[model samples]
Target: MKEDMYSIKMRAVRKEKHISGAERIISEKEIEVLVQQLTARALGHSKGKPDFINITIQNIGNQAIEYIAPLNIATITVDDYFKGRECAIKALQKSGLSCKTSQAILNMLKTCNTMRGAILLDIHSLERLEPDENRGVRVTNIDWSFKIKEDLEKALEKKGLNNNHVKEAVALASKVSNAPGIVAELCWSDDPDYTAGYVASKDVGYMRITKLKPLGDSTGGRVFCFDSSKTSIEECIEYLQKKVTLIHKIPMIKD
Candidate 1:
């Protein structure tokens, strides 16, 4: 009876089903193209040939070498045993190449296990380093790290808020059985550490949100709850469709 209810439900269901995949291996020709592009960018030259290609590369063992042509040096080496996609990216960046170029080069390097003369390249790009008059290549990148734990907590709290909102929307939709409407955040609490999902109302109590998954073993979704037990799904849905109002729609974080 509710217009667009099925569509919204389907979309919500779809977002719950997703997964990460393994990285793809690189190819030699693609590597050559990347090298050519990087060389042109770095040295301002166009030296790509039918038979061979030349570009500067840093080996995992920390050796910097130049391959004349036809060489297929892998992006990873014995020194860096774990050949992940991220590692390939680092290797490319260290060689003063852009992410796209690095990816292309990494694909080529995937062919060879180790090659002689290629040096250990630091992951920092030349452009990312600080300026130095004496240095031929200026170091520009600064090493900085964030408190991942704190960030993670904040993220989790936000997720909670989102989950709460999702539950609220669903409950409202179900209770009122009204035309499909969006349940959106109106506001959040004062605490910086709090998330949008955990906030409670004096009347509603703690809202619960149950994240749904697809048919298979896909990831994402969690169960959440609101305080009010009397609040039926249809009621919540009807309320959202007509009134669509709430206090502290966003989550709050306490210091």
Candidate 2:
């Protein structure tokens, strides 16, 4: 393979509505750095392939740069990562991240990243986690709410859903108080005279929506929810065990 500096900038998009929250808010600049670093790792320049990392941010969407090594590159334990993930999720929840986002990020850290996957394999000696009837929510499969709009647009093209129907479906999906089944909708905005697109329930680690009408009212807003009272902690744990599959040897210690 050719070794050269290459940069790929992907527009930040939510794959689904989130409710739990993120361990860390990824700024655009930080994402750029992540892309660069991951690309470099892909070229075999770093300790390993791209894994989620932490960096101090100076700004959000505008001018921003990482102030420290990515969290994954730092000297820390997997237990620390799990704890940090929980912390981040809490922060995100406070900031209004939907539950799905939390699940997606955690999943990315545990199994999707190349290095994490290797470690997980060593620890678990398994390739994937099996989801049971009671455990329907799999972290690995949970859709990132932001990415949902783009994916839904594509899914629509393939006859998966239409605009109004999607809007309606997303509306209903968002209201689901339980595990918050995925929200997929087409929405419009009243501000700025012209704005419309698809938005899913927020999945920061909790779902925030409980009905479909709100989805139709906003162009871009919270798209998911998780009613703790309805969704029992025991069920969540069982779901986590069954749905949250690791790569193999990566050890996850809950704090």
Candidate 3:
């Protein structure tokens, strides 16, 4: 008999305001412990305790294993990672963003002391798209149930690429870049053990940069860089908050 698989989504809310959310794919045996851990982490957030927490568990069956496989790629050198970071910084600069602003975004992700969700930044005006009372937008209840194109999957398989995390990131960045005014995206994991991050754009796809933060540094967040001239702030926030973004295709990889 095969073991069961589940997708657990937890959202922290305070006074009807979205605080933070976490999603994970786990085996049946790990469900209870994982939920407890996530719950504690959310409620114990440095920012204040949430008034309520919503946890959703979906039985995605064993087939979901392919979507949550461990990243087992070989290690990369520090030099290579720095080179990739410089290249990504240059690419963002070429996309109408100032080098200082781009580096600032990267640094923010590298040391995201405040446990918040994604931040929306205007590329031209350099203003944050935040609510009147809120500091940033929380992208919650994300749908990650889309299927990949068979040919694209085959292409990735041919390249020996089996990392689902990378695939999901690229797909999400692609969807975000398609939104009106969105120019690029910067993201890194909040997990203390994960140091890899990526800079993505509609024109350049995904560019992976390693060593975004020092090992054991638990700070991380995402920034969506956009142009205010092309879209209203309300529309931009709505697209990310309410839109059911699907991963139809994985954008090309840019080294």
C-alpha TM-score for every candidate: 0.17, 0.20, 0.64
Alpha carbon lDDT at 245, candidate 2: 17
Leading candidate by TM-score? 3
The local distance difference test score of model 3 is 0.63
lDDT of each: 0.24, 0.28, 0.63
Better of 2 and 3 by TM-score: 3
- Candidate 3 lDDT, tens digit per residue, 9-45? 8878777755556765556777898799779878876
Q: Which ten residues in a row have the lowest lDDT in candidate 3?
A: 64-73
Q: Measured by TM-score, how close is model 1 to the native structure? A: 0.17
Candidate 1 or 3, higher lDDT? 3
Model 3: how far residue 37 lies from native, Å: 14
Off by over 4 Å in 2: 1-194, 197-220, 233-255
lDDT of residue 52 for candidate 2: 33
True-structure lDDT of candidate 2: 0.28
Ranking by lDDT: 3, 2, 1
Using lDDT, give the best candidate's number: 3
Better of 2 and 3 by lDDT: 3
TM-score of 2: 0.20
Give per-residue CA lDDT, model 1, range 1-255, as digits (tens). 311110011000112221111111122333455454433333321111213223333222212211111111111122222333354345334434467644543333333211111111122221211122121121111101111323433544554432323333222222222212211111111112222221112222233212111122111111112113234434433333233221112222222
Rank by TM-score, descending?
3, 2, 1
